[model samples]
Target: MTNPLPIPPVTLGAINMEAEDPQALAAFWAEVTGGTPAVSGDHVYMPAAHDGGFAMFFQPMTGPRPDRAASHLDLTVPWGSRVATVDRLLDRGATHLWDVLEEYEHVQWTTLADPEGNAFCVAEHPPVAGH
Candidate 1:
C-alpha cells in the first residue's frame, strides 16, 4: 500500500447545528430542500447528499431564547427564479424584512427572515453581463 499522507486523522465526519428546536428546524429544512430526517434519542439527525452532512444534532435549551451572534446562511436566485422563489419562501412562513430599490423601476434586493429570525436576502435584480 502507498504510504499514508502526513495530514492528521479526520476526527469529524459531520456537523450538527444546535437549534432551539431541532425537530422544527429539521422539518423546515427538510420541507424546503426535500431532505430526510433521522431521529435517535433526543437528537434530530439529518443527512444530505454532500459529505460532512451526515449529522446535525439538535439539543434542547431552557429559559429565555439564546443568542446566535453569527449563525446564518444565504441563498441565491441566479436570474429568472426571483419571483417564484420569493413567493415560495413567503408561503413557507418567511417574513418580509425590506425591499431594496435601485430605482422606481428596478429592485436590487428583497430581504426576508426565516421563522426563527435568521435573515437572508433574495436578489430581485441580477447583474448583467459585460458590465
Candidate 2:
C-alpha cells in the first residue's frame, strides 16, 4: 500500500527544543556538537556541521517540561571515542543514564541527559566522510 500523492520537496530545517534557559542549553549543545551557537530574537540557533544539515534551535520554555520527551538526538562519534565523548559530556554537566554494549552485533552506545534533562545518545561508529 502506498500513497498516491507525490513526496513533498521539503527538508528538515531545524529541530526546536524548549529550554528553561536557551543560552545555557545552546552552550551545552555547542559543547556536544562543536557547533557555534548564535542568537536571533528569542531563539538560539546551533548550526549544523555541514551545509544542508538541520540546525538545532532552542527556545525559551513557557511551561512545565514534559515527563518524557517525544524524541531525542542520537549522535555518532568516531570509532573508539564513545567513552571519551561521554566523559566530556558528563564533565560538562550531563547525567549518565545507561550503556549498551552488545558483542553479538558489536553495537555500543551511551545514553545521557543534558543539564536540562533532555536525553540524547552517543554511539560509536566510523567517522562519516566530511562530517
Candidate 3:
C-alpha cells in the first residue's frame, strides 16, 4: 500500500446553517442552545458555550430546503430527560418527526425539525469524553 499522507492539524470551528431569516433562526437556536446571538450584516452568529466549543452561524438562504437533509445535529441530554427535553423543544416551535426506542436495545432518540425545517435529534447518551 502507498504511504498515507500526514493528516492535517485542523479542528471544527462552527456549523453554518442557512435560513430564510437569519436573525429569527439565530434567535431560535439561541434559545435552544442557551447561547447569545449576535448579528453582523446579513449573518448571525451564536458563539459556543466556551472557547473551542461548538459554535453555530446562520446565513441567508438562497435555495429551498431539502426533503432529506444529508446531515443533522445530534444533541445529547442527561439520562431520563429525553422526553421532557423533546416536549420543551416542541413547545419552542420544533416539529416532532419520529422516534426510535424499540428499534435497538438501550438506544433511543427522537427526531425533530427546527422552525426552518432543519432536522436534528435529541437523545439520552453519555457525554463526550472531553468538553
TM-score of each: 0.60, 0.82, 0.83
User: Candidate 1: which stretches are off by over 4 Å?
Assistant: 1-16, 49-57, 62-68, 101-108, 123-131
lDDT of 3: 0.86
Candidate 2 RMSD to the real structure: 3.8
Q: What does candidate 2 score on TM? A: 0.82
Q: How should the candidates be ordered by TM-score, best one leading? A: 3, 2, 1
**Which tens-of-lDDT digit does each residue in 21-78 have in candidate 3?**
9999888888678889889999998889765467899999889877888999988778
Candidate 2 structure quality by residue, lDDT tens digits, 1-131: 99999999988787899999999999998888778899988789988857655689999998999998899988887789999999999999999999988852545899999999999999986556788
Stretches > 4 Å off in candidate 3? 1-10, 51-53, 126-131
Least accurate stretch of 10 residues (summed lDDT) in model 3? 122-131
- Candidate that would win on TM-score: 3
Across 1-131, the per-residue lDDT of candidate 1 in tens digits comes to: 77787878876454455567777867766654456878776677776635433444455554555555365454455666766877887898778887766654434667777677667677755566686
Tell me the number of clashing residue pairs for each predicted model.
Answer: 1, 0, 0
What does the lDDT read for residue 121 in candidate 1?
75
- Candidate 1 pairs with clashing backbones: 16-56
Better structure of 1 and 2 per lDDT: 2
* Per-model root-mean-square deviation over C-alphas: 6.5, 3.8, 3.6
The lowest-lDDT stretch of 10 consecutive residues in candidate 1 is 49-58
Ranking by lDDT: 2, 3, 1
